[model samples]
Every structure is written in structure tokens, then in C-alpha cells.
Target: MYLQHPDDPEKGEVSESDSIIRTYQTYNKPYELQPEDIISLRIASLTPAEFDFVKQYEEQLGIIRKLNQYNQGTQDGGNQNNMRMQGMGAVGEEGSGLMPIMLDRQQTGFTIDRKGNLELPEIGEVQLSGLSIREAEELIKSKLINYFETPVVRIQLLSFHFTVLGEVNNEGRYTSFDPETNVIDAITLAENLTDFADRSRLKVVRFSGSEAQVYYVNTLREDLVSQKGFYLQPNDLIVVPALRARQSRRYLLPATTNIIGVTASALSLILIILNQTQ
Candidate 1:
């Protein structure tokens, strides 16, 4: 996240740590936070429960990597490897543009069509409206197998993503195939919250078929990953509320009220004195 140092009058770009140090210096009026001051920021400091949730995705990612390597002809020499190669060759002439089926990319909230089908070049209209990218690939490949021997189809989610807004540095939409991304990822993609962001008042808006649901997430105390309630779905919208300055408003309110009251009292006194004199 980008931030400005309180010491630096120019307000140039600075890291989150630097900004926090400057804030400490400004408030405490003690030792100025220097670059040499020791500091560290890493996920290693997270609680065990938090680490478990984060590592769950890591293990899943590893398994997905293995599966991809196996599917992409990366196995070492063995019976299983040879059989896989033979099966691939059984499809048709190798690299004839017939074996590899390329599917059209889809964006977030993209529906197949009115008929709930996708039109491929040779295959024509095939059902794939509500299926995910992986599911769509499997269905397409299964159908192609009837015509070809072993069809290898490549599929990708082109527009599977949502937008994050409000008190964030970079507010925009980001794409991802993994459906596990939660509110934290959404905020992280927006470069985290600004210094004046209210962590306790973050809001998430999700649009369904004919309605939208709104949720409030407290970033300071909430468990982002565990709370599936705040997890982002396709086309979800996140908004971080700006921090309301307590002193500025609270102090000004009573002072302004007193001033107005005093002014009215003075005006009444002046009117009374003028009437008596007349």
C-alpha cells in the first residue's frame, strides 16, 4: 500500500511501515521514526488458526500443479507415461489442429446464450451456460471424444472477477479462477486500505439473479478466511468506508452548538435593552 510520511512535507510515496512509524512519531512527539528503526512484516507472525487457513490454499495449489503437469505430458518414462502418450496419439494426426480444442474465453457473469449452449467451430452448439470453466472443458471434451479419439481441450476463465472500491489506493476489478478468494484478497488487490480507512465499517455487495445482498465486515477483528459469509463470489463488490475523524466532529459539534446558543442569547438581550430604552 502507498502512504505519505508525516515528517516528509512533500508527502512522497512510502511503505505501510514507514507511514505507521511516521504516525507514531507525529502522535507521540518522541523519537522520529528513522529508516534504520528495526521493523518486519510477514505472514509468519500470524496466529496458528490464520496460518492453517492460508496454508489450505497452498496445499490445494500444489495438488492442482501436479494434476496440470500430469495432463500436459510432463511425466517421466514409465508404463503410465507411455500409455498416456499412446492414448494421445490415438486421437488423430499429431498437431493437426484437430486434437487440441480451444474454447472461447468467458468474462465474469457471462452466460452461454439464450439456449444455454456455446457454439464451437466444428462442434456447433454445445451445452455450457451455467458450468464453470473446468466443467465446461470436461463436457466439451467428452462430446468431442465421440468424433475424435482423445480430445484435448484448453479452457480459461477470461472475465471471472469482481471490483473493489472505496478507501483503497487501487480500486478496480481483478480476475481469478480460484473461488476461494475472500474479502481480504479483494482488499489486498486494491492495495489494502488507506490510512484514513475505517476497518470496522467495510461493506460487501453481492448481486444475485434479481437482487443484491449487502454485508458489513470488520477487518480489525474478523477472521477473513474462515468467515465464508464475507467471501467474495463472482461479480461481488467491496467498499471500504473512509475513517470518520472523531476529534474533528465530536469537538466541533458542542463548540458550534454553544456558539450558536450564545449568539441567540446575546441577540435577545440586545432586543430587550433596545425596547426598554425606546
Candidate 2:
């Protein structure tokens, strides 16, 4: 558990110049591409001779943008309907009815092969296993240098998703395009933490190569913002465990009450039989 620093009311009137504050540096590292990661690749020409190719690429991008807009509209309508159902007490679970809507609105992107390679138009099978987005763009640019004069390459990770499980209102996988997404953002996507959530024992699980690393985060503290695990990566898993009190109330108390009720009923029946014999 994490505690906040106590604020003194009597000593609060300090000048800004006299106050001392400590700051911690946060890691803003770029994400490396991995197997099964979906990405969008675009190669633009700097010269006029290849303008036709650029036009074709732009048209394709326009079509994708339109499709994404339509999907977003559909998702919004679904969310509104779900909310209405919830308010009417028709929906039982928090995220139960939204999965199909989310799946239907998913955007298709190019998936990286198991061998750590990506096959692109004109440039086939480029090894992008351990490279960052910028490095991969440079590699693609170099490959197209002989064919075109100074090809401008742009690569964006399209499938940026993370999972939130346990004590959240909406526990499921969420996708976003923001590179600077943090734990708070991920939780917000899952409709924030539930009332029974244990904030002090939140867990973030990340996988690197063949090993998985788990990091404990204390959401109640201010120092969590400076922690490296504060910012979430693609495919990160956030687990918010339920509080002990909630578990006892939801499961233990009911079982104990049922046993007591049965015992009382049995004792009453035996007393009734004794009275009849008398």
C-alpha cells in the first residue's frame, strides 16, 4: 500500500522560491515491433515521376479512413444502445454486450509473420524483428532507394491493444493509436476500476521474448507517475484484484448464513417431535 505525504495547514504558506521539490525522470522509450504485430506501411515518392504511385497510395489511405469513420459511428451507436439497456436494468454484466460490436468495428492491418518479417508492396520480406518504427522506416527507405529517388517511408503500428482483467467495470481488450498511453488510459478504456478494486495491488504483466515480467503498481501514490511501468505497451495486461472485504461479502457471508439457517431449521424440527411425544 502507498501513502500520500501529509500536508500541514499551518506550514502551507511557503513561498515558491523557498519550497524544494524532487523530480524523477520518466522513460519515454519507443516500442519495438514484434511478431503478430499489425502495422501500416506507406512509401511516398519525392520525385514527380512517381506521383502516380503516391496518388494511388493516398487514395487507398482515404478509403481506409472512410471505413474507420463508418466503424466508429457504428460502435458509438452500439454503446448508446447498451447504455440505455443498462439504465433499464436489461443488461446484467458490465461488458457483456459490447464485444461483438467492438469486433465488428476492428480495422484490418498487415500482421508481422512468425519469422519476424513483413512483406510489403514492392519490398517483400524485410526483417523487422527487433527494430523500432523509425529504424524499420529507414530500412524500407534504403531498400527502395535504387528504384525511386529518396522514397519517403512512413510506418505506424495499427494494432495497439492492451487487456484489462479483474475488478474493472468493463474488463476486456481495448485498442488505440496513442503511443503515450498509460495505465490510467488503459483502465479508462475498460470503464475505470470498480468499487471493489484493490488499487494498491494493481499488476501489469508484460512479455519480452520468451519471458513474461510482472510489475506491481500502487495507484494510490503520486510517485507512480514517474515509474517506467506507468506507461503501458502494446499487449500489456492490467489486472486489478478485488478487495478482501468485497470477496467476503460476495461469497463467504452468504455461505455462512445458509449453514446457520439449515442448522436452526433442523433444531426446530427435533424440538417439535419431542413436544408431540410428551
Candidate 3:
């Protein structure tokens, strides 16, 4: 599992990159629901047409996503993981002839207000703040039990997003369906860093209560895996500045190419004139 440098067969370095590793201080803690968070909640019932919007929403969202991919003309994106932490497994008609239900629709989700409560269309207002995804699903399923016999509930945090800016092919906000995202994952979602990106200056900003904490990382260093900045928190902002010294090269590259082209053209013209005069 190693690749030797082509010019020097004895040299091997990048082969170590075969595996990516990262560690987080909050690795064990699941992301808790916060005010202004958006969640998609769906339930399964015995009634055939019951809670059909969940399935329809998923279908519509798929269409819109496909159209977006087509319009953007780029296929590079992080895989949107389906986080089924609990409740309902598959679409089966085991004995009741009912399909497992889910919450999704044209990407529309219930937003938790400033009070940390979601005013769901079906279940009314429910306080979901400070609750993890698993906890929220459990609570919602418990409530659905009063309505449907053998009810199944599914939820997705549609508002889980992060922003990647500077020194990347695609610089913008990206939705993360999975909460366990790391530095490499975020950069990949941004289509990886550009050639001018400074690997030693990867800056990550995390907003804590009333304050912002910044972490710096050097991707070229092997110790980065153990660094606190290795793992990206929800809503983290990643800014990768261009190589400090080589940044000028980004603009100089075109000018250098033009100079070379002009010099080559002049040389060709001089050779032609000499041949004609001789």
C-alpha cells in the first residue's frame, strides 16, 4: 500500500496518505438541537395514505437536487448520508402491508424557533432544544404511539450546514447530513483545496456561547490527526488562505505565460528572416 516517487524509486512519502484520521474532543457528544434549527419529522401509520407527504417530499427533493447538479455543471460533492439513528428500518410490507415512513419533502423542514420549539403541522409545538437527534426521535415516536398502533418515526436535521471559504475550487455553504464531519470531509465537500491553498494555514472558526474560538492546523504535518481542529463542529467556518509567498504566482502565472509566448514568437520570426537573407 505504497507508491514510490517515479523519479526516485527509493523515495516514498505520499503513500502514507492512504488513510485519513482525525480526533475530536467532543467526539462522544452528539449534536444537540439549537434554536433556529430545522428538522424534518415523519411518522408511519397503518392508514395507507397516512403521512404520505414524507415520501413525496423525499421524491421532490431528489428532483430538485438533480436539477441543481445539472445546472451547476460539477459533480463533486460530499455524500449525503442517511442518518437513521433509530425508528423504522426498511420499506417492507412484512405482515401489515405498510411501507416504512420517513420525513422529507422538497427539502422543507420545521424550523425550531428562538424558543427552541418546533410548531409541527401534525404534532403541534414540541420543545426540542438541547436534545440530540436520537433523543428527539424517541420523544416524537413516543408521542405518535397515541395515534398510530406500531408507529414509526424518522427525523433529519435539514439545517445542519457549514461554510468553506477561500483557496478552494468551490467556496460556499454546504449541508452536512451527517454530524461526524472532519477537516478532510469539509475540504472534500468544497471540491478540495486549490493549487494555491496554504496547507499550513487551515483556519477553523467555532462559535461558542458569546465567543468565537479559532483553531489553526497544518495539513502537511503528521500530528494534525491529534489536533483539536481536526474535527469540524456543526456550523464551523473553514477559511483556507492562499500560500502567503506564492499567492502572487496566481496573478503572475498568466503574465509569465504571455512573456514566454512572445519570446518564442520573436525567436521564430528571427530564424525565418535569417534563412531568407542567406
Candidate 4:
């Protein structure tokens, strides 16, 4: 039921102008890292001794994560086996009693601690929170100069996720590698908005520090493309509300149809009974 606007304007209608020009320019803007943000840091051109020193810690972390996953799997399997031996119970009883285990096995990325600092292999702890991606890369590069000759430092943000809810065809959370993801791009990921979606009252909720900001968008307007809320940030949520007419059709129409069906059936039964009795 999702509808896409026409790519070309029809005859006698005004052409759709570009939305990018009206919206706040986001070109060349880098996203600032925050606490709990995961980032991938790669260091190259290290001497053999330096490589050995860093490799040791990396291997240790990898081995520890593998062991943890193995232990968790073994424990879960043992519990399931015990339940099976005690007469397998109901169909979903075993799984119902067991809690789902979520494991964070990201070995390559560095997680920013609550203190907004990350402790590297040899570079030690560096304050990274509130710094843009480019700034973080330069800061880490400067720190590496003390150890390696012309060290190549590459930094990338690993967590860029957003959510789309309400009257979308497929409402769910999605991940994007592109930092300049727009509102249209996010909606496209969810298979676009449903026909019943209220084009005049779309909402984008964004969090900045401790404050939550909401931006209202009108998709039907020609200037929607130029709105500041068009460009979505990490953890931003886009909600498309349903039209009032669509809501009535969804809830009331079905009940009305059911009532009409039951009344007609009862009337037919009564007529048949009268004919038989007469």
C-alpha cells in the first residue's frame, strides 16, 4: 500500500524544485562521537616490535571473547538437555523458561567508556567523546607519532542506526553507513510510507545531550526536501502518522461490515423458520 511520488511533474502542474537547497547544508559535516559509541581504529606502518606488542593484546582479547561464547553455549546446551531428560514438557515451555542471551562480540571496534575515553593497545587512554570523527582521527594520529614512523591511522564510526515507526510499510530499526542519510532515504529503507500515512504531519524526534527535539515535516509540500529535519542523525526516529480517514476505515469499517453480515444472516434464518412453520 506504499506509494511513491511521480518522478516527473504532470502537464499543467508546477515542476518540483530541489529540496537540498532549502535545507540546512550538511555537506562535509562530521558526526561527533559520544559515550557508548563504537568506533573502528586501524593502525598501520608499525615496526616489528610495535606490531608484536599490539598483536599480543589483540590476540588475548580475541581468545577471551571466544572462550566466553563457548562457555555460554555449553551452559545453555546443558540446561536444555536437562529439561529434555525431565520429559520435554510443552511445545515452547523449554524456550519460554530460558532467557535469550545477547553477546557483544565486536573485537575490532573500540567502545567509548562511560567516561568518554578509550584505552588503546599502546597509545593508552584518550578522551574522544564530543570530538568529530576527523578530530578523533587526528588526535589518535598525533598520539601514534610518538611510537611509529608515519603511522597510517584510520578511524570509522561503527554505530549509525535509526528507527522508523508508525504508518510505514515496514517499520523497524535500520543501520546506515552514510552519515548524511536523509529523511527520504530512511523512509525508503522501510519500504516507504503506506497509503494511509498522513503526509502533512510527519515527525522526526532527535536527542541532543539531555534534551529531546521534535521536528514536524509536511511531505505534501514542495519545500519538504529543504527542511532541516530531512537529514537524519544517528538514533533519530521518524514517525508517519495515519490519516483520520484511514484510521476510521481500519477500526470502524470492519465492525460495521460484521454487524451488517450478522443482521442479514439472522433475517434470512427468521424468514426460513417462518416458511417452515407455516
Candidate 5:
């Protein structure tokens, strides 16, 4: 069961002084992934600044183009793959018998390292660090054809996991299923962002190659929704910020103290004047 620290909600951050409050440990949070947890995903609430960062990093990393090609399917007819139907004997194609071979790279339970590479069993070191699941499958199949009899291979995104930190219901890691997974889908899987989550301060931190980049997404406004497109790559990290209540309270405290001080001064002057006149 995943337990959230109560002190995490208060000071906007979990402070060292909050170690005493252990109320969440009593509930025995469910061990399984709950639908409610996804809503609090980091991408749901992004700040304008962070959004620009996301755009900048994506532009440099080729994430945008890759995602588009992945979704739209290549003009070269990659999407026309009828392997499933061919395997079922709906239509007989060459190597149809071997089509039953499931070698979907994305289907494999593995995560790409910083270099965009995966370590396969017999294949040894297969470089798939940046390529999408579909792309990786093609590379693997092309290579495996030499060894097997009409090698039947299918690749899948076995572990589509990402981490979400900061102001959300369940601020931890969430994994997604293959193909249907996306940014919004992950957030939905995390149970959606909480009301106290600052929609204007959302961030998506990701590691590209050996370096890490942070992209900002905004949930406060809707202008950029169309531009976000779909699907999140593996190793993405989202972070939602705390609400403005803490800042507002900090500002009000000093003002209230000043007002009280002014009122006392005015009263003292009035008393002085009265005494002088007497």
C-alpha cells in the first residue's frame, strides 16, 4: 500500500520537522494501482515557463516528430501491417505461418537506458534508446530474420512507467499499457490532479541521452492543449506545484501586523494630544 505523508500537504513541501505525523501509515493504502491515483499526474498542471521548457527540449530531442510519425504511421506503409490478420489465416501472406511469432519490442518488459538502447538476451546490446516501440520492433525483426525460420517477431511497450512528484493525491511512479498510453492517459491513470495542485506550475522532466531536460505544461489555461499532441515516451517525469494559499497567507501575515501597529500608534498620539491639552 502507498501511503502519503500528511505533512506533505502543509508546508508546500515535506519538511524534516514533520516526521512525527504518521497518520497515513494507519490506513494501509491499497497495494494495487487505483484509477483515482492518475488524476494527480504532473502534466495536468503546467506553468507557462515550464511549457516553454517542454517545447524547447522536445524541439531538440526529436520527440515531437517521432511522436507524430508514430501516431500517423509512416507514408512508407508501416501502418498497413496486417500481421495479426495474416497470422489468423484471414489472408495468406508470405511467412504467414511465422507471423504468429510475438516479437513486439515494446511488448518486452524492458526500459531503454540513457543511450536509447536495450539489452536483449541473444541479440546482446540492441540500440533502442530513442526509437519508439514500433521502430525498435522493426530493427529487431530485421536482424532476427537471419537466425529463425521466417522469424515472427512483435515488439511492445511492456513498461511504460513515469514518475510524478509534488502536489498530487498519489505523488509517485505510474506505469502504462502499450499503444493506448499518452500524457493525459497517464495523468488520468494517476487519478487526476488535486484542486490544490497549481495548474500553472506543472513540469515534465525527462532524460534525453545522458542529459535531463525539463518541459513545462500548463493546466491553468487551454491555449496549448491542441499543440501538446499525444503519447508520452518512457522515462518521462511530471511535477505539479502546490496551490497559492501558502504564498497568499505569507503576504497577509505581515500586512496584518503592520495594520495593528499603525492603529496602536494612532491611539497613542490621540492620548498624548489629550494630555497636552489638559
Candidate 6:
């Protein structure tokens, strides 16, 4: 149980040593923007912090921006109840709740329509689906050129989330704000695994369009950092199976207790009969 993660890698050599090596590797494929994905899109102009350009565009473009959809929402119930919409503004200084609310990763923010189009205040609808975060940012910045000389745009993906099940303390869908979420970070989010969790046989199931890939990992090894499953993607499912002994005990302990109880009852009845006879 205490092995793997050798101090050195040599031909035909192995050692059992815990390592604290920190090797950060980027994901092979970045998550592309998906339709119906929720993202916090912030647009700010340098020097003058105001949305005066929006009013001008309304008259010039003859388009109406239903900005009330951004301002007039009492955080809905469920997971979004705790997320507060503060300092909200289309574009302004501090305390101005402009476009994009940091309300939460799952509930609040701009939702891309099913057509892969994101509707903005001035730029109307821009196709953001199938584009990476950096690509989307540059596209949005280009669209803002007609409005301001220099527009600073920030797009934070809030729809990145994963699921944890089996042996974890809290088994549910968890939101990860960081783009590079590791398996260890996910375990911590689930409040760590249960006592019966098998540290050596952790399973990571990753799903693509119509295919699912599974990976088995040992949480105790230092080589975990170099594993392909180290960086978790959206919709990844992590399952920490229980040890064999733990699974056996689940069935064995209750049966053993029942046998002991029956034996005690039989002994009590025998003693009562002997006392009556005496």
C-alpha cells in the first residue's frame, strides 16, 4: 500500500518513497466555449468609466438592449441563492454593477444562446461558441473598437464544473473557477474521501461528444502530477472505490453481530430454564 513514486528512475530499479515534486503541465486541449454556457463578461473603458456609448448606440443602431435582464434579478433559489449581484454596471467605476455579475459559476452571468451567439449591450449578438477563451477575448475586443478607443474586456468562464462520487464525503457536482483544476483540488472540494476509500485505485471517467475514457490512478504516488488525468476537464467524473476489506466488512460485520445476538439469547433462555428447575 505504501509504494510507487521512486526517488529516482533507473532501469530495472524501483523504490517506495513519497515525493513532493511540483511539475505543472498545461492541458493538451483547452476547453472551447460551448452554447448555453454561462460566462462572466466584463467590459470596461479606460479613462472614462461610463456606459455613455450604449445610449448613443441605441439611437444610431435603432436597437434596444434589455439591460434590465442584467439589473433586475433577485438571485433565484437553490445553488444561486447565496450569489449576490453587487457593483453591477454595464461599464463604470467601483461599486458599479456593470455588465457581468460575479454572482456564481453556475447561476449568474451571460448565457450563450443555443445558436452559439452571445448578445451584448452594444455589439448585438457575437458568435462565441467553438472559440477558446483567448480567441473569444480578442473577438470581443475587436467588436468594441467602434465604441471606445481602448476597451478592456475580461471573460471568466463560470460553467466549468465536475462531479465526484463514491467514497467522497460530499458526492455532487462542484464548480471550478480555475481553468486548470487538478484531481487533488477536486477531492478537497468534495470534503475529502471516506475512510473506506481506496487511495490506490481512484478512477477518473472523462466523456467527450459520444465517447467516455476511463483512467485508474493511485492517489498516494508522486507520479500523479504527471498523469493525464491530473488536470480535470468539465463534466469529469471521479470515483474513489472502497477497499476490498472495507467492502467485505460492510456485509460481514452485520452478520457477525446477528450471530452473536442469537447466541446470547439462547444462553439466557437456558439459564432461566435451569433456575426454574432448581
For model 3, the stretches where C-alpha displacement exceeds 4 angstroms are 1-28, 45-48, 51-107, 221-226, 247-278
TM-score of 4: 0.69
Which ten residues in a row are the worst by lDDT in model 5? 34-43
Q: Worst 10-residue stretch by lDDT in candidate 6?
A: 60-69
- Compose the digit string of candidate 3's lDDT tens values, residues 112-168: 899998664455788899999889888877766655668677777777678999999
Task: Give the per-residue lDDT digits (tens) of candidate 2, residues 1-278.
Answer: 23344452346685567565656677768888888887776666856654545345545655675456546656665445212222222456455443232222223456689988987555568999799999998998898887677789888887788899999999898888877898888878998888899988899998777888998888887677777778888989999999999999999999999999999999999999999999
Candidate with better TM-score, 2 vs 4: 2
Q: Candidate 3: deviation at residue 98, Å? A: 35
TM-score of each prediction: 0.47, 0.70, 0.59, 0.69, 0.43, 0.68
| lDDT (10s digit) by residue, model 4, range 1-278 | 12224453466775567654333333334688899987767767646654644446655766675566556666666334212222334676664343333333244466899999988777789999989987888898898787777877777777788999999899998878677788879888999888889988889999998988999877776556667787788899999999999999999999999999999999999999999999
Candidate 6 lDDT tens digits, 106-169:
4446779999998877678999999988899999989988877687777888888799999989
* Global lDDT of each candidate: 0.55, 0.75, 0.71, 0.75, 0.51, 0.75
- lDDT for model 3: 0.71
TM-score (C-alpha) between model 3 and the true structure: 0.59
Instruction: Give me the candidate number with maximum TM-score.
Output: 2
Clashing pairs in 3: 57-105
User: Which pairs clash inside model 2?
Assistant: none
Compute the lDDT for candidate 4. 0.75
Higher-lDDT candidate of 2 and 5? 2
Candidate 1 Cα misplacement greater than 4 A, ranges:
1-111, 246-278
